[model samples]
Structures are given as C-alpha cells and as structure tokens.
Target: MAFKLPVHCPSCETMLSVSQLSCPECSTVVSGNYDLPLFLQLTRDEQDFIMQFILNSGSLKEMAAQMGNSYPTVRNKLDDIIGKINQLKNKNGKDDD
Candidate 1:
C-alpha cells in the first residue's frame, strides 16, 4: 500500500484520502498541491456546506435548499469557510514575503 497522509474529518472524524478533492461525507477538498492546511480543519458539515456553496456559485438560497438548512445558516457557514480561506492566503503570502 502507498503511504497516505493521516487526514481525518474535523467534524465526523472520518479518514480522508490524499487525492480526494472533497470529503466523501463532507465534500471538503482534502488534498491539493497548494501550500495550505488540510480541509479536515473544518467540520464535515462545514466542508459539505462549502462544497455546495461553491457548486451553487455562492448562492445561499441554493445551498440552503440542497443542505436543508435556512438561508442564514448557509450564508454563515459560507462566510466562515471564506474566512478560513482568506486566513490561509494571508499566511501563505506572509511566508512568501
């Protein structure tokens, strides 16, 4: 067996594959070439929420419907995910500089 990184879902604690773009349960991107943290930092629900948000083109209404959640809830989750991405970007930028 090939060596695999020990990545797990932050929410459900599910094992994640390094080649997976999104978590099987949460739909969060777990692996990539980008110099950033793993997606497992976020909960499975958060990961799933983000994947749906992106797929819906950042439409909260669509995400809410897909997730069976209220619009505000979906929006809040998106905001949180975006904030994390921003933080990662800032950190990476600082590292490069």
Candidate 2:
C-alpha cells in the first residue's frame, strides 16, 4: 500500500523535512533538508476540497450541492483557503525580502 507523504512528525507533531531521496533504477541517493510546497502544507481535507472545487469547474454552487452545504458555507471554506494561501505567500515574500 502506498502511504501519504507525512508533513509533520508522527510522534511529536513537529514539522518534518525531506532528508533523502533514492533513484529506483540507478540506486543513486541524495540527502538534504527539503521544504514542502505551500499547497502540501494544507490539511488533507483542505486539499480534497480544492480538488473538488477544481472538478466542479470552480463553481461554488456545485461544490455546495455536492458537499450538502449552503453556497455561503462553501464560499466561506474557499475564503479560508484563500486566506491561508495569501498568508503563506506574504510570509514567503517577507522571507525573500
């Protein structure tokens, strides 16, 4: 069975970094601390919500119907996601500056 990539420490709930990668064909290995993309930092539920939103062609009404929620509810969720993304972008921008 395939496992989902872990974004946090299973034991202490700390953030995790990629320490190594291996090539399947050549058995080559590389090691380093790596950061996850901004999107990967989102909760699994949020990621699923994004996938659903995309599959519905960005229709909040469709998402609301599919999720058995009101349009406002779906919109609020989308707004929350947007806020998170904006916060991450701002943080990254600040880091660059």
Candidate 3:
C-alpha cells in the first residue's frame, strides 16, 4: 500500500522537502532538495474535496449533494481552499522575489 506523503517535520512542524526520487521501471534514482507543489501542501481532506469538486464538474450543488452538506457549506469550503491557495501563491511569490 502506498503511504501518504508527509508535509511537515514531526518534531519542528516545519514544511518538509523532497530530497530523493526513484523510478519504479528502471532502478534510476534522482536526488535533489525540492519544495512540494502548493496543492500537495494542503491537507488531505482539502485535496480530496478539490478532487471531488472536479469530478462533479465544478458544481457546488453537486458537491454539496455528494458530501451530504448544504450548498453554502460546500461553497464556504471551496472559498477557504481558494484562500489557502492564494496564500501559498503569495508566499511563494515573495520567496521568489
């Protein structure tokens, strides 16, 4: 079974960096320090919500039905995720600058 990728350090709670990657087909390995994509840094629930939203064709009503939540609740959840993505983007932009 595949394990979830951890996004933070256990002790310090700092964001974790990807340092190595290996190919399953060939035994080739690549090593480098890298930050995960903004999306991957989000909580798993957040990721799943985004996935479900896409699967529902970006329909908030459909997502609400699928999740057994009110439409406003689903909209709030989506809005929260959008805010998080924007924050991450801004942080990355500053880091780049």
Candidate topping TM-score: 3
User: Which candidate, 1 or 3, would have the higher TM-score against the true structure?
Assistant: 3
Task: List TM-scores for all candidates, in order.
Answer: 0.48, 0.81, 0.90
Query: Which model, 2 or 3, shows the larger lDDT?
Result: 3
lDDT of 3 by residue, 22-89 (tens): 99999899999988888898999999999998888999998898789999999999999998888888
Please give the CA lDDT of all the candidate structures. Answer: 0.65, 0.87, 0.90
Residue-by-residue lDDT tens digits, candidate 1, 6-93: 5565789754444546767977775554432546545567677767767888788987887799988877777788787667557556
Error of 3 at 97 (Å): 16
In the range 1-97, model 2's lDDT, one tens digit per residue, is 9999899999999767778999999999999987667788788999999999999999999999988999999999999998887887786564421
Off by over 4 Å in 2: 92-97
What is residue 76's positional error in candidate 3, in angstroms?
A: 0.5
Note the residue pairs that clash in candidate 3: none
Error in Å for residue 54 of model 2: 1.0
Task: Give candidate 3 misplaced runs (Cα > 4 Å).
Answer: 94-97
Residue 31 of model 3 has an lDDT of 100
TM-score (C-alpha, index-matched) for candidate 1:
0.48
